[model samples]
Target: MMHRTQRQIRTDEPSVAAEALSVTHVTHGLTVEDSGEGFAFEERVRGTALLSLESTRCTGTLSGAVEPGRAMMIVWVKSGSAVVDDNPVKVGRPVLYRQDPQRFRWVDVQHDVLRIDRTIVEQVAAERGDWAPGPLEFRPRHVPEGAPLAAWWLMVRSVAQEVLQGPADVPVERERELARFAAGGLLTAIPHWPVGQHEPVMASTARFARAETFLLDHATEQITVNDVAEAAGLSVRGVQAAFQRHHGITPTMYLRRIRLLLAREQLEAGDDRSVAEIARATGFAHLGRFAGSYRQEFGELPRQTALAARE
Candidate 1:
């Protein structure tokens, strides 16, 4: 959840710029072969542990080869263009760089770039049931230039303007949420395996019951659908399908219900804890939201219920 904003690296020396690129972009063995006269490189970066969005502008000619790090980068040419590994990069087209060594030569290129952690892509692929037990692969080409590309472009821009560059004090949860959004958008825009395939299997009654029991047991702990799926021995999609088919609700909703019920029980027991304490003990994040949800589930707010129990 480390957050950095408006970090700038501007230099006129090729070696200095190369070193900066090595650290910021997480590349290794980067060597600059040619730096034409008046060479300049500048980058404005904003990022967290999950992803980074950068605006880079360079003048003159630069050529180098880099050992790709652990990130998957998508570059959108804004003003100028470059050739990535001999593939001609054009303006307005976003090119994806996979987790392989890259050779590049660019002349006066300015790019708006997004680098996402490879682990995030793999996690999303697993949750969508589109991945195997091996390395995740993507088509190393420009995203298709139609609705898909438009949607991905809009999403990235929105996230950059609103979440990354919008405010300095944004919540960590909001950052994680936007990172997941960008990851999901990237998967859709780029071509990958298991797309439009792998329909979830309906969970059996026994498996569904096991999932319910797991939720009830872990109601006071911070858990996710993936945890429930693991406990029930099912895929994430399978567990979601099971919940929809059996209870007409999501697994998250069921967990919330269990938490609310537990909170009510604590109140009825005349526990000497404040409503906020009860809400937090029952795993709610916000007191106001908890009170609203509690009132909706039962007939009164948590404080009202506690007062009645005292009477």
Candidate 2:
């Protein structure tokens, strides 16, 4: 239920903010308190971002140990000033909660504020950019400026409306595209090294086919990025860029999928090996995560696959 595609919840209770927003800080044990004068909170969540519009009788404080994976939390203070962690969050200025999620502590939300909390990552954008993939961090700035900021906000709003407002059960490919666009926009908007996005490379079916052949051949081995790169006669980044461009998937993801298929094939063949042994033999080192992934992809775990084969 945590990965609900879209949700719109409105509550007048200030007590529900913490539970309503399953953000890292709050869920990781941040204590939040709003002065109980009059409060209205609305949360709109799409696949990759959580947008909140909160108006409280008084300001609320988010205090506790910071949880990680806050790739980006762009906070725009619609009205009164907020105090984020130890710093003052000025009105009309966008406060970025994390360039580093681990270093961030807390947020004190002022009354009568409409805020935006964008969950961001640039890595998923695939081969659209030349920038080295890593955590998309921003410099400490009160108001995030320029055309990209406005453009990104606008795009997110448009995508949210389309995805969240659309009929039930948005398709999986559309969801994946949404994630790629959001992350791609962030990468375009933010100031980062290896500057500027290269135009998206057209997918090369031949290249992907070649890579696929190599991967299928060595699917049972513990291959690293370097190995793939070397076999492909390209640099690591080049391999990633190529796979991402052509297949809309990274080499690692492609390898994992192939391995999962191999594992399933083995299971369905009713091989004498146990599930754990088969998983290990197929280069799925973490048995639990492998089973989880198998269930997700094949709609049955490895054990179930074996059972179905026997039956």
Candidate 3:
């Protein structure tokens, strides 16, 4: 299940602030230097076992060395400036920090950090048939810039607000999907592989048919692209290509369409359930989004459909 945790520290003592930072960040050898009398630190972290979204803000100068851990760390400085490993990081620029010890200094900085397990990255690489024998390596500092950077930030915030903020008892399957979503976004936003190293595999019509069947059969359940690929006997990339070539949409979109249809049916049938209930029953976790998408697809809100059915 996904979980959310928060911590805040406001104190004049540097030791207190340093302790908070080390505990929250799971860092080692963290030291606070010259806090200038007092500091405020706060962090909100929400994630499952595979990925974590951390938003941290510090209202004073903090400097320390962070040892490289097993997870891949991606950070975006939202407001203030920082220097990592003597490389100046600008506001709104994404930074991939991993595999090496990092010396950092932050002055009144607000940043969002994504920690994804290395195993998840490797699994994604394997799904794309891009995995080599050795450990997967990503360019340490090559993150998206300009419009791509904006898009990546948008994706991160969306997942943080929409998906990760859902009910704590969210199914394990949904958590897995969430992890994969984060991993996929990171892989897309960063440069990990050679541009033309892997050729795209063409998926046959039969494979697409099988995938479609699997989606229809399991539309209301939480499932990942990996499940679809397995059902279609194709790689994840292969299943995605199959969907795009056949229906001009991705497998996830197709599955969402099916769920929307199911939700509409339940609404129109006067199932005696609330709109939110029907939404969750049909695999929509966020009610506002469910209502919006329902309206867009059917030209009426879910309540309108149920009201008409009752009349």
Candidate 4:
């Protein structure tokens, strides 16, 4: 197949999300707008692709596009702050994010823009074995600002913008390699659990692994930290520390990611299901709370998701 060039189209109507899929081809672009509340866009993507989006104004949540055969690396390109799972991320330097294939993320995006690339990253990650863990949900733990991986990503961002200007002579494999280099730097920066001055703690590792497995298997049910800790034979504190050390978030936030992901699948499929029905089906029992979280997790509300589905 011939290499496809990225395309950009602007719309002012709240109802234009329906047009995203007709393009068929992959995309990379920037969105500039003023809305206390942000927005969302979804498209099918395969192969390695890169997208950089930086906002000059606005702060909101971003959700959607989590599925198998897809991978993304998102960076914060603006100078400001956004709350991830209620945790604030200071902006300016880019934040590396991987989408969880089995779940959706409630990314706190500030006025800063985001850069995203799809399949090419998966291929590079395949070599590293870290890619198969599924899309990463949390920011990779603290790596110094000028790390090699960070520098490489900065380069990729420049190249992505160039490709947008005009078709380049670079081969697809070369583009793929560039993506690989970026992914390599990112994976290396992820913080490992139980990393301390001592050896890996068996008690901590086992507890964390068990809790993670339980959450993945039972995301559809109403669950709590106590339940997860009991199931994993660990104390609540232990489970919390494990997630914090490895993923940089609490267990509850992780579960919310799973719940939102299920809701997104229904919303994107454009099924006959109602928005409220989707909320309940996904284990969100309260309509108001569900709508608020859904909106916070994604830049748009549940109704918008259903509306996009109909399109």
How accurate locally, in lDDT, is each candidate?
0.70, 0.53, 0.69, 0.50
- Candidate 1: clashing pairs of residues: none
lDDT of 4 by residue, 165-257 (tens): 434445765555445545533443342222222322221234555576566556668888888999888899988986665444687876665
Q: How many collisions per candidate?
A: 0, 0, 0, 13
Go through the candidates in order and give the C-alpha RMSD of each one to the true structure: 16.5, 18.7, 12.2, 17.6
Instruction: Score every model by TM-score.
Output: 0.57, 0.45, 0.60, 0.39
1 versus 3: better TM-score goes to: 3
Candidate 3 residue 293 Cα shift, in angstroms, is: 13
Q: Write the per-residue lDDT of candidate 3 for residues 1-311, one digit (tens) a residue.
A: 54644444566566777887787565656766655645767766766556677777777787877754777778889888799989888776778886667888888889988877767765655554434523555655665643234335534755786445577666666666666656655764565553334433321134654575566556678889999999888899999997775444688876676677667767877867899998898888889998898888779999999999999
**Winner of 1 and 4 under TM-score:** 1
Question: By lDDT, highest first, what's the ranking?
Answer: 1, 3, 2, 4
Question: Residue by residue across 1-311, what tens digits does model 2's lDDT show?
Answer: 12435455666665676666554233345555554555555555444333222333224454454433443445555554456556766654445555333332333343322223233254442234333454433444535433334334544555555555565555555555555555544543443332243322321123333344455557678878788777656778888887676446787886777677667767877867899998998789999999999988778878988988888
Model 2 ranges with Cα > 4 A deviation: 1-4, 8-14, 22-29, 48-71, 90-93, 99-120, 124-132, 194-311
Better of 3 and 4 by lDDT: 3
Candidate 1 vs 2: which has more TM-score: 1
Model 3, residue 19: C-alpha shift (Å): 0.8
Extract clashing residue pairs from model 2. none
- In candidate 1, what are the lDDT values of residues 1-311, reduced to their tens digit? 45556678988887887777777765545654344557778988887666778888888565666554677678888776588889888777778886776777777888888877776666655554424523565665645643345446545755787656566656777666666667755764665543344333321135655575566567778999999999989999999997765444687886777677668767877878998898898899899999999998787999999999999
